[model samples]
Target chain A: MSSPAQQSAGKPVAFVSAQALRARMHDAVNDPHLRQSFRGAMDFLMAKRAAQFPDQGELDSLRSLSESIRQYSLSKLPDLLEQLEANLTRNGVQVHWAETPEEANAIMLGIAQRHAARLIVKGKSMVSEEIEFNHAMEAAGVGALESDMGEYIVQLAGEKPSHIIMPAIHQTKQQIAKLFAEHIPGVDYTDNVDALIQIGRRVLREKFEVADIGLSGVNFAVAETGTLCLVENEGNGRMCTTVPKVHIAITGIEKVVEKLEHVAPLFSILTRSATGQAVSTYFNMISGPRRGEDKDGPEEVHLVLLDNGRSQAYADEQLRKTLQCIRCGACMNHCPVYTRIGGHAYGTTYPGPIGKIISPHMMGLEQTHLLPTASSLCGACGEVCPVKIPIPELLIRLRGEANSAPHANPAMVGQGAAYDPKISLLWKLWARLYARPATYRAFTWLATRFRALTPTQQSGWTAARTPLKPASRRLRDMVKDRR
Target chain B: MSSPSHGANTPRTYPSRPQAVYFYGTCLVDMFVPEAGMDAITLLEREGIRVIFPDNQTCCGQPAFTSGFPDEARRVVEAQLDLFPGNHPIVVPSGSCAGMIRWHWEKVCAGDPALKARAEAISARTYELAEFLLHVLGFNRKDEGPATTVTLHTSCSARREMGTHLVGRELLARLGNVTLAHHDHESECCGFGGTFSLKHPDVSTAMVSDKVASLKATGASQLVTADCGCMLNITQRAAREDQDAGRACASLPGEHLATFLLRRTGGSPCGDQK
Candidate 1:
């Protein structure tokens, strides 16, 4: 976690608070280069995902099944976690529990010190980002390197991942070429995508070979088989988990499923929705560390199950739907708000529709309250969601939660910023006026009669358009005249 | 009276058209665009159905509801509900207002059982103008107006909540002399999300601009939309942009679907009656 001071010192802005979101949004919209980057990338991703689900019937059924499966797993999450722990222990893997990010980091650092690990290679784990593992490791004098190409570029540039699935999605190849030229020991600048991949591969291969510990993120943790399923296209995931002396996998506790069969459909839609691949090149299911009979794998395996407020989401029935997210990035790709502002403006580990809903749970609504309001409630995120998370409904619910009265139970995170006494009183007065026929008629009469008095310099309305002027007469009065 | 029997996802069908329809002139139409409301009444009366204007009707409570004040929304919505208490289909001139009643009313009133029942009852009978014409009345008429090209802007709520975008397209297709030109990103929102527009001005401005650009790309002579909120946003932006570019704002302002349908059909019947 970058402290407030560190965040301010950093070149790229992170650590977003709800109050800062609007200003960030303003800057993001004004930057044409950033707009074009996100717009083109989102359009490409939307087109690709649309092609994969050509048949709407198939898509609907898959979504329904996925929703049911996730709901079922979440309903029995506590029991499933216990089963998973037992099974993993039986398979000779140490499973550690963490209630918060600090605890999770401390546990990982303790493991690192125990093994006297100097360097760790990581396979694209969002959970690691959530804990700010790289910073913690660096502070503890341990070298932590990102093996995924996107993560590596973002890390090298001293910036956080702007996007979820495609971390450096906001960067153009030219910008990346420049970054590589500036950072790499001896690399010629190149804009070719394949050449860039080769450069990343060459550097990460040596790191993987020399690294003492391997860190990874679990896509699905199967309780029945005690397996941690990882999906990736790059071969780095394999190298990081198998070649290193010790392997550590960190994941949110909500990622668990009851049975191995459940992984089939979720995996199918996860890749199809995220980047449009039918299936990823690699699907590594690690059940245990290397045994005497096993040839090429780590000597020991450890799993750090981080809660970090996931239990709070799981406790609420409606909010629990947020946990169904497979991190496919489909919602963000189809989201108009995210497309305009991109990921950096959100200033969270996760950005876009998923970030808005889930971050409130992880980081609390005080910091993320404005995220829900950022949307136009266009429903594109919900429409394209693979797991059928009702994002719009959740947003509305979050808004209501944010505006709840101070006396309300649950002691909500934001204390309802919209629920100002003055605003509430204003709405009450407006509702009262509209609720009665005589007051409603009298108000409209006054509004139409004093049309000229309507201000031309209204705050947001007249900024880009002409002032709103009331009509000469109301429809009811006109109807009476015609009669 | 028998209720319309439409399954969850199936296309709605009416067994027989109701003799009388209650016209809920949305607060926007009742205030800013009375012509659309009058045209709606004229069209319904011409179709041999009695149009009853509920005098006490004001707003649909969507503004309050969507702005995160369900209590305020309930009070306003409950007022309108009592005015249309019967089996008569409640036809709204704008899809946005109709969507408020159809999709969100019950949710808004979920805290109280009696109010929830009232909301569900009222929501069942509510229909957007185009939806009523396409589904209930099964309106199919030959266009008698001049040949013209028109593009349609489907409001976000109408498209997502009410599924009235299809009905609007079908209604437009029924006209003989009208060519319905489709824009590239017609499904995208115009960003008039009630309070959302005011709260996030820059984002709203950018979104409305994109929508206008799409409409201009269609090269249609006229633009028709169902929701007054969207019409207000698009027309205002169009006029502003045209002025900024130092061009004569010759483009016809966006028309509500009801007004467009009435004019294209043969003008309002009230004038003929007079």
Candidate 2:
């Protein structure tokens, strides 16, 4: 028998590791408040998304087309990236490349410092969260303010975004009301969402006027037209890109596409999948810095392409599909695991199915291996994926890769901690036992004969369930007796 | 839906009413719930289709396959594949196991052409019990039992791979007396994902608790499911909860669809005992 510590050591660990994730999940699951909040929100989102695609044929057709476009884009990612850089440069936009999060943050800080920027207004960006951009900026004495309502609330609370699309999904309106009342100057508590939003808008609107540099994320970077598209329901993304003197867009290298036309189908499904909106209120496109004739736009526009572990994913054929994600949280909203525990339990920038498959590439298997194992292989994520990423298959493949023997693939990123020689030997022994009829019969016979000896206190198995004991007689024995 | 071809081979067709079928009584049904296996056989026999049970068969290796040990899974799968050599329809009592044979067998045996061909052959003929009853045999037996209210829990693979949930629903609908109650979040997994339950028990238990709660809300006394893993998890969880409350054993009984079909359709009396 293994000790508790040994058993835990045997399981996969995440970037935050399994121990921390399990502890967090234990608290999250025990909290009826958290569970109910996620349950209601996810159900509402799932229903709204369902209502958008009433025609199954149309949904299937759109999904297939979107999948093909993503596949085509990923196939020529290197050439497309080069083309994107060339086109953006031709449009008078300076394109900077960063191979890691540290480099990405350094590049952004350098640009801010060169411009002598003090206050920076930002749209919602998960990539920024991944790099801890706010903390980095704060260390440099630059105040970065979140303009998106959910991001602003989480920022004020000194908390990370729980859900990717719905950043503050884990917080109730009452909680937000209290947060704002306590944090904001001269503000009364209000539980109404509209009232809460208005308060946030009023506060962020002031930051937009005073900010020297605007920072945002790109939904899609079109190589053909050198266009960077940003989608959002709130106008903060528009304000961040246009209101300031200089605008900087940071995105993973995989976000670049071959043509502007491809963004239409992706955008169509993306908003519908995320928050179930037919279209976002703002579809801001930034092609270049403000020209002499331009009315209202930033004087300097720069695009920062961040590779931070994405090139590693792009190296492997199967892992490349992780790049096909369009940042739509449909997979999370429809995910039973995510709906139950909420997103914070994942302990990563992205959460739910997308996070499970993608985080390992960024953080390495040594840290994020447990994320893939967190799923029950329900395939709901894959089913609802607008771009039709085979998420479950990728998860299983990751599991296999994580458990692969050390030095098995010297090229892979992290050495999986879950790969145990003892467990491998045990599986081999079991397989060998089942390889022949005699040994199989011997084992089944003994198992049935000593069924009463089955332990009543099986770990995890009997915690909330009855013990699974063997039957009094084997099926083969029963068949032979009947014959 | 018909099975798609993998390589150069064309799709194979099974007879509308097969003379015989090799019943792949999955390892779960064999040891844990033999009545389900027996009931499956009884249902087929009543339809005048001969049932052949190869005693050497153990499992389809889904536990290993889904647990990240594909090589071990391939070994076990190969052993099972070697047991059934003929072209008879391979009908399984559980959709979870059947799906492993139909969809994943070829995948695990991808490199070896000979093994892959054998895997595809077996997969093409494999069918979940409900799917076989509805689609293959076109069984239209009249409803014979008294009225019973029940809700069905379709396993993840069953719904996703085989689309047997529809088949289960259609099969149950044919039994005019059985009232199928609608439950919210019916399509979600019950969290009995083989090793997943043991590995992540807290999450699994939470999911099952919600599943049981949904099942209970329908006001159905009995819960029917087509997969043994799900049935065992649901029933055992209910029993343990009942015990915790100091109530009677097995508060909410979850029966396999084969057992439900056998008893409700009057195929055999022995199957009703479980």
Question: Would you list the C-alpha lDDT of every candidate in the order shown?
Answer: 0.84, 0.84
User: What's model 1's overall lDDT?
Assistant: 0.84
Model 2 lDDT, residue A359, Cα: 86
How far residue B40's Cα lies from its native spot in candidate 2, in Å, is 0.2
TM-score of chain A of 1: 0.95
Give the alpha carbon lDDT tens digit for every residue of A1-483 in model 2.
111112223232224564477777778888899899999999999999999998877888888888899999999998999999999999989999999888998999999999899888899998988888887777676777888888887777667788999999888888899988877778898998888888888888877998999999999999999999999988899999999999999999999899989999999999998988899999988999999988989999999999878888888887898999999999999889999899888888888999998888888888777778888888788888998888887888888877768776643577555688887888888787776667777888888899898788877778678899887876666666656
CAPRI quality band, candidate 2: medium
Candidate 2 regions with alpha-carbon error over 4 angstroms: A1-19, B1-15, B269-274
**Candidate 1: stretches off by over 4 Å:** A1-16, B1-15, B250-252, B269-274
Clash pairs detected, candidate 2: A14-A17, A14-A367, A15-A367
Q: Across residues B1-274, which tens digit of lDDT does each residue of candidate 2 receive?
A: 2332111122235467778899898877777787777778888988999888897898898878887888998988889877777778999988888988988899888878899899988888899898899888887888899998999999888787776668789988999999999899999989888887887888888998899889888989799988989988888988888888999756688888888888887676444454
Q: State the DockQ of every prediction.
A: 0.53, 0.49
